[model samples]
Target: MQAQKFDLVSPEFKRNPFPVFSEMRSCGSIVQAKLPLIGRVWMATTYDAAVDMLRDHERFPQQAVRNGKKNVAGIKWWMPKALKVLTNNMLLQDEPDHRRLRGLVEQAFMQHSIEEFRPRIETIVDQFLDELELKFKQSGSVDLIEHFARPFPLAIICELMGLPDEDRPMFSRWAQGITNSGSIFSFLSMIPKLWKMNGYFTQQFKKCRVNPVPGLLSSLVSAEQDGHQLSEDELLAMAFLLLFAGHETTVHSLSGSVWTLLQHADQLEALQANWSNIDLAIEELLRFLTPVQMTKPRIAAMDMEFHGQPIQQGDYIIALLAAANCDPEKFDRPEVLNLLRDPNPHLAFGSGIHVCLGLKLARAEMAIALEKLFSRFPKLHLAVPEKELQWKKMLGLRSLLKLPVKLA
Candidate 1:
């Protein structure tokens, strides 16, 4: 029997997606599905399929033009021209372009480089927690999303990008606009904000060129100026990609970890009892939570059979990362949240060359944030009933609208 089609953006899926994902896996490793803006495409529903699809760049390239087709996955006719600046990022590139774009700023996100920022991240996390504590004292409750989740990573990314601290709030506004892109109409609504953001990036690039700063942006600007490494559009695209992606995913990852832990009190207490294995525990949380559910759409490079599904050249392919993370074949009792599930190879950060660039920074930020949050508020509990918690209606993201918690 065919599995029932599911709307990724629907509240039902957001509330409890495991059952639907299970049904999808039962059908096959690959399934045909329709997305809000991207129409019909193949979805990699199991771990093996996700790995296969993500790693096979030759067969399934990100740039559709490489497949001898012109139907770009997410780009649409109605999309504002200005928005093209953001899509020119490395995420949508293939081969030489991808390698070239990635190499330009890869050093800053390397393990050792991110490790150097650990102390700074801890200070920032502590400062935010201190404010959260004060807010809880004054108001008797605090929304973790509003008070900590949204601003914490934003501050870190802004500081890393050499963006002024005062402009951090404006970036949050722009981030919110991007998160609401679930449907064509909603996406259209965000165009104006995106245009404004693009303009802001242009201004920042100009500033960096005139007076080089001490962060990643200035370095990128220098790369562009010296021997014309990055083009004007690519520079703007990189800025948008780094600033937007740097914080947006981390925000949901941090908040979702907190929510999941609160839901599974046993796991929460287990991790709290032994903070040394936080790195392991976070892997489990990332797997269970599955932030950034689907990967960026990959286009088929030729007519081929992918896990028994005949995919035409240029047909859009997306790895249902959230589904793959929970595949029972890969993970034992996949539905259960296991904090110390070692060898837990989850695709939360994807696989292969196109994998997340800021993964190291993201992991470090999450570790510090989670450690301090629980240690500081041992009595922290949800302010509202668990069922009352509302998630945003955005597709490809599992973000809580608010995480109200009480502090003793």
Candidate 2:
């Protein structure tokens, strides 16, 4: 089949993309396509294809080689140097470099470490719920994204990284300005925010070196493993990745989880009746929602035929995580949301070596957020009709612009 093109970032597509993905899957497991700002690429649409491409790093590496030069992701040759630095994170590396960078701070995100973080996350979640309660009482309604969803995870991630609480609001501003880079104009407009973020992170790094405060920043500053240490540029890249990924994705996950439950009153009631295994419910939501829609652009490592499609060296490929999660071959009634889906092998956090480092923490936060939310506000309902809800037009992320809710 010829390379296909579609508006993946359009509001219409953002609202419901499964049918489009289904069409793509019917054509082939891996179909060639074109994405804005990323150029022609292959999109892995099925569970098996997605897993194979993600695991076969040798054929499609995170780092790319073009014109005898190495580049990361789909970065253009003329893009600004600052943008390149931000994209040069561990998520876009391969092999030894990826392993070395990941090892530096892996301990803090381990399952045991995240488990210990439960009480603190609970405290934070409750605090946000309390604030939401006050706002709801005063106004009779609240935008969950503003009052709770966005700030809640941002606060947790900032605190976890030892950033000042006062700076939390600015991070959101920067994130909003830069999250959707589907167009060249939008991409260029975020340079200022990028500059500010880079400057702020640099100052924090210096402070850590001089005074050595607590949190991940301090640990990363002094962290060394096997005689390997992070350089200043790498430090900036790593910090950006963690801060953005740690909170931004969770913001959507939390908000989307609430929206999903509100849509399915039956599932909501079922969960409220028994909070014993809310983790199961959260997993199902993760699969059903699939917040981060696409994997980082992977470069074809060599010329080869993948599932009968001829792929040339330097071609780009992206695994559609949302599509893969809902592949009918993998899940029974993949379109339906089952709260108690056991053995749910969803790729929401992805698979292979580049799997999300914060999966455990994210899952914990979601579970806690859901449990505390419903327990406190069982009568909660949407303030506006579902059809009027808005989803951000950001590529590769499934985020709600706002989730207005009424607390009764």
Candidate 3:
């Protein structure tokens, strides 16, 4: 298969990509495709193929080769001191290193598990919804992304990290700066932002050292100090990763899910009528609109034949989770949204070792937020036309710039 160039950032594809994905999936599982800024790569577009590629970590490693010729199709940023720290995060790690870092993070969560988070998350949801009501009352409308989706998890993550709620806006700015590295020019543009973000994290780490708080950041700092395979660089990376990873996708997913349900009124009504089906609704939402659309690019470990295609060592491969989630072979009605979808084995959180570290927490936030949102505003709806909604071109994620809604 020739490397078919599919400009990922093109507005045409970004607007409504299911048709494109359907076309790609119809061709085969692992299609030779090229992203706008990421050059050529094997795109796994089917459910079985995506799962196989993701699960077979040994054959398709997560780490890019140390000295591989990384052709930046988009923008490339200089790996400054701070970014190098961020690069050492678990998302980009393989094998023992991944295990160790993930173990530490797991240990932290074990001490403060998901069940413990529900009450607090629920309380936070109520407050945010109340605030949303106030915003609607004051302004007659609200951008859900800015007013609700974004703030809900930002506040939760801040509380988890023992960071100040007041600093959430700052965190969101840094996160947007970091994750919006979609183009070469945009990637180059975020250097100063990265530096600034790292400096702020450094200050926060120092604060944690002085008077530690009962949060994940303090625990990670202590782990680093105790010499638990957690370097200062990794520590900073983990801290940033937690804040960045914890909320970015969830915010987008929540916003997108709301927008999606509103578009499909029957699904919204069905879910609202039967609260027991929320888990199914969340599953369908994750699958139908997989927010973290694709898994990070994986490099082939060595020469191998995959589904009759030759993969050379160090070649990059991308698993299209969004496409897989919508595969006709796996989903009965791949294009439609069914809140009561059963046996939903979606790969929205990915698979194998590198699956999302905070899947449970993400589910909790989605479930709580959606229930409260729908129940509170039974007559809630989109303020603007659906055609006007703008999606950010973050390579591996589906994010909306804004989602205006009226809670009347």
Candidate 4:
């Protein structure tokens, strides 16, 4: 029998996806699906198949099927031309191009280099927690998303990007506009803000070229000025991707961890009993939560058989990372939220050369944020019931709209 078809963005899929994902897994590792706006896609519903698709970039290229310069299925035709600069980003490149773009900033994100920022991150967390505590005392409850989760990583990214302190609010606004790109209409709604953000980054690049300093943006400027390794558009695209991704994913990751920890008291108590279980606990949470639910469509480079399934050239392929993370074959008791599930190699940050560059930094930030939040507020928990809590209505991202908590 042919596999069942699903609407990737349906409200049913958004509410409780695991059961549906399990159904998808049973149907086949690769199930046919339709996404809003962009038509058909092949959703990889198992761990091995998802990894195979992600890691094999040669057969499944990162770049979308483009008609000369136009994207085959991207932004709408009416959107302004300025937003096209978002193309050529590292995540959308392959081969030497991907290697070159990723290498430019990988040094700064090296685990060791990121380790240097641990103390700073801790200090930031404590500072935010202090305010969050005050808010809890005054209001009797706190929205963790607004109070801590959002600002925690945003501050870090601002410092890393050398964004001025006053400009963080503006940057946050622009990022919200950019990451809310669920459909063509939503993206269309955000275009004015996107254009503003693009122009802002463009101006910053020009300024950085004249006056370089010690930060990722400055590093890009130095590389461009010294070796001309990056073009103007590439530099803008890199900065744009970093700003949106650096804080956005981390914010969702932190909030999702907190939400699940609060819900699963056993897991929460487990982590509290042995803080050393943090590393393992986080891995499990990442696997269980899988912040990035699905990856961008990786088009088939040529007509080929993918895992016994016939795929044609230019066919859209999507790896259901959330499904893969929870695959029963890959992890023992994948449904159970076991905090100490070692060897829990989840596809949260994805795989292959296009893997998330900020993985280490994200891990460090999440560790510190969760540790301090729990320690400071042992009785910390959800103010709203699980069903009442809202998840962002995004097509491919699993994130909370807000996490209201009583930090007493």
lDDT of 2 at 320: 95
Compared with the true structure, what per-residue lDDT tens digits does model 2 show for residues 1-408? 688876677777777888887888898989988877777789999999999999998887887754223555445565678767876899988888898899887954442377677899999999999999999989989999999988999998898898999999999888877786667788888888888888999999999999987688888888888887789999999999999999889989999999999989998898899998798998999999999999998888788899878888888889999999999999999889899999899999999989999998899899988898889999999999999999888889988899999988
lDDT of 3 by residue, 1-408 (tens): 688866555556666779889888777888888776666789899999999999998888776754153522223245655476765689888887888889888877676787988999999999999999999999999998888998899999889888987888888887777777777777778778778878888998899889998888888777642366566788888987898899888998899899889889987887888999899889999998898888878888888899768888878888899999999899998888888889999999999899999999999999999999999999999888888888887777777889999999
Q: Give the clashing pairs for model 1.
A: none
Task: Write the residue-wise lDDT of candidate 1 on 101-182 in tens digits.
Answer: 8988784344238878889999999999999999998999999998999999999999898899999999999898878776
In lDDT terms, how accurate is model 3?
A: 0.84
Could you tell which candidate, 1 or 3, scores higher by lDDT? 1
Is 2 or 4 the stronger prediction by lDDT?
2
RMSD of each: 1.9, 1.6, 2.0, 2.2
Ranking by lDDT: 2, 1, 3, 4
Residue 228 lDDT, candidate 3, scale 0-100:
66
lDDT of each: 0.86, 0.87, 0.84, 0.81
Give candidate 4's error at residue 408 in angstroms: 1.0
List candidate 3 stretches off by more than 4 Å.
66-77, 224-229
lDDT of 4 by residue, 271-348 (tens): 898899898888888888888899888888888888778888888888999999989999898888888888888999
What are the runs in model 4 whose C-alpha is more than 4 Å off?
A: 1-4, 10-12, 65-72, 76-78, 108-112, 224-226
lDDT assessment of candidate 1: 0.86
Candidate 2: 10-residue stretch with minimal lDDT: 66-75
